[model samples]
Target: MESHTSVVLSLYRHGVTRENQEKIYIGWTDVPVAEEGIDLLMKTKANRPEAERVISSDLKRCVQSADYLFPEEKKIYHKGLREIHFGDWEGKKADELSKRKDFATWLEDPENMRPENGESFEEFSTRIQESWEMIREWCFQDGVKKIAIVSHGGPIRQLLTLLAPAEKPFWEWKPLHGQGITLYWQDAEAFRRGERCTSLSAVPIMEKENG
Candidate 1:
């Protein structure tokens, strides 16, 4: 029954790459953040004081977002938190890929589908779960009550789907761009149990035009 204190703040993908801006699926491309992406991170930090400590993926966009939002000394880069590698489809257009039978199956039940040459969804899920455990341990050891993580949409969605199962439609579980979810772990047992203090409202969505 011992109580432990920690918080998990997850940031969705930011800073659209040229491919992204072109509406392409730039999965696992290690693209850097766009100028507007830096602005978005700056604005987020200016509004959320709890985001003082940042853990980000080693990818360029994530690293750039972290560097812009947090002081250099306060940032930590974790490779385990990187995006799901999309293999041969790394920079393909989503619309074009969606027409493929395999892609349709992937969209229907991602758990069973593996993109050509890419890691399976199960593999990506396992890595993300491991990263979460590491973060939880670090937070407990350091008595950290709040922390921020900058990572890709795929991992963020995976975590959210695991943490907060949707009562409505399954599609509702997806995480939006630049959006975040705040999770509070009251104690070690509750943390282990995956209990949260409460779920906060979605991060205010920036206009798509602005993005």
Candidate 2:
């Protein structure tokens, strides 16, 4: 077999919004960055990596953050990298949904019972994985080895959960807003197989002296 080709992905969670500040489950909601999140997002810029290209979720928050972080790089807007659609719960805070049994069920088994009209974990993972394959294929064919992805927490979490060295659940690998993680894939095929690659230490947005 041919030796595996490597690729580096610098994945970032987009800046926050007023809904995020209000502790709302802000998924599939097109809103701009909030006042408080401005400073947090700026910190991410200081930790920027040299990327061959930029890809962003089509959501306003990610698109705006991508432009701010990488003003010169070409941005490819893709909806496949969007946050999991919250559907009826798009704007509801966690506290507001704490009493709903469906919420509890979703927490335990998201693949079985999802939010009303929202995507199940299975569906979300499938689409994201497919999109990821396409992105990697495009990059590999173009002689690209590194790229930056500006996206939401949900998609970033999936990448982490799938790429983590040890097995973990969704909530266990939560990435903060504007925070990120770098994935070192064994090869492009690893992404398609959903196989774990080398373990990368989590990349925090505001942490200093990350050596």
Candidate 3:
């Protein structure tokens, strides 16, 4: 018998895109996954967990990844799950922005600085928190035991920093393209409270089939 209080949450980063390969800031840009990323995901699909529910960002990259990874599962898309809006920096690389004084200031205190026309880190985190609360409520209502979330690197990292059992900084929780982490919660109370999960494990990865 399944415990109603227990839930498994897997957070998968969308496959890499051309902008990712180019090391550009791609928040809210809506790019498709690259060929290389698709191939890699295809090879690893067998290892991904089967979930009762799948949630995803509405952005093109994450939506495409959910199709590749959870082909049979119906997905709930949320714009709030989207990556932080990079605003003026969208599609630009760090080196290109490095010369700007605003960029340097943002790097030092991103929580307080908003890229001209971009979302401040504080705003982004607040959006994510709301999205997460919604997801938890949905799980409770639907009696979901396992759930998968397909999102961008920034959003996934932010989630892990908040929920992973270990005490890791935001950047330290980075998940590679098409990869994810699984968090196990023994009680729904912790999930509802947005407390850290009791345990966590890396989602298994298999090498590309043709490689």
C-alpha lDDT score of every prediction, in listed order: 0.68, 0.79, 0.87
Number of the predicted model whose TM-score against the real structure is largest: 3
Task: Indicate which candidate wins on lDDT.
Answer: 3
Of the two candidates 2 and 3, the one with more favorable TM-score, higher being better, is: 3
Could you give candidate 2's per-residue lDDT for residues 1-211 as a string of tens digits? 1237766778888877888888898788899987666677777777766689799999999998887778788999999999988788888998998898989888777767889878777888888888887887677668676788999887888877766777788778777787667777767666445568665655555544565
Residue 97 Cα positional deviation in candidate 2, in Å, after optimal superposition: 2.6
Candidate 1 vs candidate 2, lDDT winner: 2
RMSD of each candidate relative to the true structure: 3.9, 3.6, 1.9
Each model's TM-score, in the order given? 0.80, 0.85, 0.93
Superposed Cα deviation of residue 179, candidate 3 (Å): 0.6
Worst 10 residues of 1 by lDDT: 162-171
True-structure lDDT of candidate 2: 0.79
TM-score of model 3 vs. true structure: 0.93
lDDT of 1 by residue, 1-211 (tens): 2364445454555555566677776666877777766666666555443564688888888787766656543888899988888888788888888778988898888778999899898898899988988886676566565677878777776666666534333346666554466654545556655554345445554433554
Superposed by TM-score, candidate 2 places the C-alpha of residue 10 at a distance from the truth, in angstroms, of 0.7
Candidate 3 lDDT over residue span 75-179, tens digit each: 989999999998999989989999999999999988789998999898999999889988888787677878999998888888888888878988777698988
User: Which candidate do you rate higher for TM-score, 1 or 2?
Assistant: 2
